[model samples]
Target: MMFDNKKVDSGTIGYFDTQQENHFFDRKSARIAVAKLSQSISAFANADGGELLIGVEDDKTWRGFASVEDANPLLDTAFDRLKSGYFDAEFLNSDHFPGFVLHLSIERSPSVVYSTSDEAYIRNNAQNKKVTGERLDSLRRSKGDITYESHAIPASLEDLTNSETMIHFMLESDRISEPSEFLRKQGLLIDGNPTVAALLLYSDHPQGQLPHAGIKIYRYETSGEARRDFLSGVPLTIEGPIYTLIRRAEETAQKIIDSIPRLDQGSGLTKIEYPVETLHEILTNAVLHRDYGTRDYVHIKIFDNRIEVESPGRLPANITPQNILDERFARNPLIQRGINRFPDPPNMDIGEGLNTAFQAMERLRLNLPYINESGDHVRVTIPHEPLASPQEAIVNYVRESGRINNSTARTVTKIEQERTIRRYFAELVDAGELAQRGSGRGTYYEIP
Candidate 1:
């Protein structure tokens, strides 16, 4: 294969023959194993990306070919035919074996895979079968021909506020062009009236109309306490527009950030120890993907050392935590499109956001983002203490202050303006280093 390392010992190369539940090869040479190939390719692309090694014996043995010259022509023909198909496929040939080994790599793309016959198929374990009628129905129900944005709610367009929508559009002008036209194109308006998506994105009081479109934020000193508080105590709910909901969530997150105690350093320049992009990515994902079908609103919980964003409903069919990164299944396509219009559209590339969140945390030495499924809810948890050797100065500042603002962080730490202090503060709070207070310009930092 093109990836074969001659220096790699035989044992490593031989490992390719071991078939996992998701990989397969042709039992007979030259004849295409349609089902086996489809199942392996789809499964690996759906799950974490994996390799499919071909031309290796079923018994995990590599036999030297009778003639390399003869086999070369056959391999070339097979690969050429496979490439012409709809699904994206790559071919590799290895000479390390006495004859040659073929390696096929499949990458997940936005486009769904269908057989050359144009039939959608899914792999169950080792079986390659057409998608069931029930599965197709589920897919239709999830999004349908009309997206969430275009769906007309029972309410009138007059119920939506244009000024609010225009303000938000202006705020995100850098990300979109021709805001009014963009809104119309996204089905945010109907006959000069605002659609539900438009109302959610632009209205100041969207909850008054939909009643179920707001977010609930809760804070507790401990995880158990936070759970108990939500279960029995007064849940702090923030009901308003989607933009307001996002702002409130960020504010609440900042408060949680300020609770972490920072260690005092004589120098004013405080090193921010938390990964901000990861926090923003998680929050943005929750807002964009949350299920709007249910009356239950999205819930956010802050604990002494962690923050959890609980979105309504289970992941769309065919999507799981393991496959979420590779799969580009979106429950709210219209919502996704609208959000993407924002200047900083939260990660849109297939399987990049979650992976980026994980990688960023790893690089910052912060705890990896945690994903949990409970019935219809998907909760993503980002902890603060992903890294050791905490910055004492930052910790002390958070411990003493109730909250911190971007200006304070910039003045205290002297970080660049473009760098997000909110994210850093939120990570610190999640790690039990600081807390946040206030909002907008009044926002300030304090020790947790």
Candidate 2:
């Protein structure tokens, strides 16, 4: 299939409401429960957002609203139960296709909002779950409305020290000496009290205060099957200031990558692999953007096929995984700003880290890393291979470059999973005007 930039999936438009989804289909299933309807609106606003189809049913029936005017009073009643400044009437409209139904598109809010009944709701797996306590705080942090890094911690400037990391940061960023003055100048210290960012950056022992602050690495010998010993061994913990944590994780991950061997499918040869730059950027981003308030450590897992780095937070604000590469919203601005001062920092390019990682993967003919936001954790997976199958990479490579070979084919395609590239080669030979040359591993394919 030819992928393009068109937002509307014409083929799947007819498939909406066949089953339950993030979108709610009202269809006058019952009277609009004002309190209940308000929950949906608040949930959508707090979470990643969703649509409210007023005249659609769960079984794919388009039951028209008794008249759009009839639902106005009901919608208003529901709106009254929602917190002020959260929803807008501009989102409500009628469409002809779904039986002249009303559509309410809720954009994810940047702030934490609640219902007038003093309850906050978040959309989770096509349902609205009420949020309270730490979960609500987590939601607020996810939306970038509040950052835990700037919060005051029970520490003084003495708790912080002039470590080698601090010295490096001072020289690299060309800042003035006197760590106390620098901390005060950067708002990391207020009234002689140290902020979370201050201790994490300049302290010799940040974990002494914030026990949750650190990195954990595990080399899982996963058999890729259902087993009890999935992790396979003991884990390694990386401690110290946040910069040190990032570096430790980077070194461990690089060590794993360098020691491994990758098989080339087309050539049937094994070669010593190299560390992907994507891991460095991702690990740095995880540390910089993680939720520091929670008692969770950054976890890095190295497997046979992929590496998973999980941070203790969701994507901040309106930055979803879908728009993460194109959007910019810093969860911890102080950390981001201060970390840039560190010598040989992993994130030299600030906002371009993820996008750069993806481009670098493509340049090396490997599969782009998969990024996902699962509940309270944001996990990024960097695979040690190419995109799935010989068909996709081989067809595209041969189509664009106009030829392919056993050596160049594996290099470009990264097709290491399969025993042979013959299936895709035969496919192209039968469909496209492809011809084979030579014999065995020395053989190549051409289009003439």
Candidate 3:
């Protein structure tokens, strides 16, 4: 069969595509390319599908190969691998290279493609990497058209809290057309037995079944050191029903927000400089997407100027920072759905929470949210800035008066007189140009 050279376009050079100086070619070795091909296929399937042209150059250079006679045998071997049921592969058309080139097209079905060993891979940017370890585990548990969300949990009926589970079932039931039947079809509860995911979401004491499921909130008074004190704050540990846990987390977050002094905007408006919705979205996301399989719980660290919410798990399969907003791979579908049933659940649609937080920050004209992933944990830091512009007033006060109290600073910056001068004090303190006097009400801030 003859192949049409016009069909292929220039792409990057990697395991999946071979460079011919000018054009690119798909790797010819069935055994050698199968692994990378599987990853490319999986990534495309996981994301918006795209074409994978072989025998092309990274810089759009194309050097035509011999002919179909030279590439057909390799193509046959590759097709056999797909037919074996170890992976999902499709044959598009070879018209592109009628005689001189070979073209193959693969599509992703709702079914996940696995290797002979049942291992999966996802493409990262231009590279195909194995989706293993925690990342893979999280992906396997994700909710998607062909994912395993419909599967039942392994435990017995006694493992679940029926009353609590029914409440969630009822709430979700009202939204869908057929609640009970849908629950049965989704394998949420079989023969009145809760699936592992169901138990985690609705059980009064989900931790009894999945002890690792919980949220850890910590407050630290930094002494300008890396590791410092347990200090004057409390560490709130919450577990049990997903609904209760979310509520507790939100309440805990609010308490931490309350602890930080509010800006004294002289105006009647009580606007927080940092978007409260942004904080809610980040914290809610941490709880929803966290990997419950790991013993580590979600952690919230309240520092002087910023709050960091660290969830236990890394990015889901085939997900990265660039495409995080465009695509969403929920680590816990059951938990996600359960949270949504709450009076105010988080927005997980297409990973919009992160984007919402970002937009909110941009609206407030504050710094961007800080995201860090280490090992199996993802930490998001949101800093609190002054709601009203205080730099000029702060500089004037410091330069003229030489010092000012928390109250005096706000007085000088009349822009928004109600906001406590604490924000200005914190900025100055962070800059190493301010010091505090006395304690409590007697405490006053002055330029040092």
1-448 per-residue lDDT for model 1 (tens digits) = 3323233455666565454545333232323355445544544443233445555565655643354444454444334333333233233334555554445555432234444454545444554556646453332333232244455665555434346655666665753555566666666777776677776776667777678777777766533533442332456777665555676776666755665454446765343344666766777677777766555788877665577888876566456676676777666766666656655555455346677777778776666777876755788888867443334445555556644567666554545553566667778768866656777668666665
Q: Rank the candidates by TM-score, best first.
A: 2, 3, 1
Report the C-alpha displacement of residue 113, candidate 2, in angstroms: 3.9
TM-score of every prediction relative to native: 0.50, 0.74, 0.53
Highest lDDT model number: 2
Instruction: Return the TM-score for candidate 2, rounded to 2 decimals.
Output: 0.74
In model 3, where is the ten-residue run with the lowest total lDDT?
A: 21-30
lDDT of each: 0.57, 0.72, 0.59
Better of 1 and 3 by lDDT: 3
Q: Model 3 over residues 1-448: C-alpha lDDT tens digits?
A: 2334443323322323443321111333222354555555555444333455544344433333454444454455445434343232232223332223334554333334564346676545555557777566554543132233334556655435345555565675565544445455656886665666676665677677677678878876656466564555567888867666767887876776676554465865343446877887887788777766656888888776678888876556545545666776776676577566656555545367888888788667577787866656778888776444576667667778776766776566653453556766777788877777778777776666
Better of 2 and 3 by TM-score: 2
Candidate 1's displacement at residue 156, Å, is 2.4
Report clash pairs, candidate 2. none
Provide C-alpha RMSD values for all models, in order.
13.2, 8.1, 13.6
Displacement of residue 173 (Cα, Å) in model 2 is 5.3
Model 2 lDDT vs. the true structure? 0.72
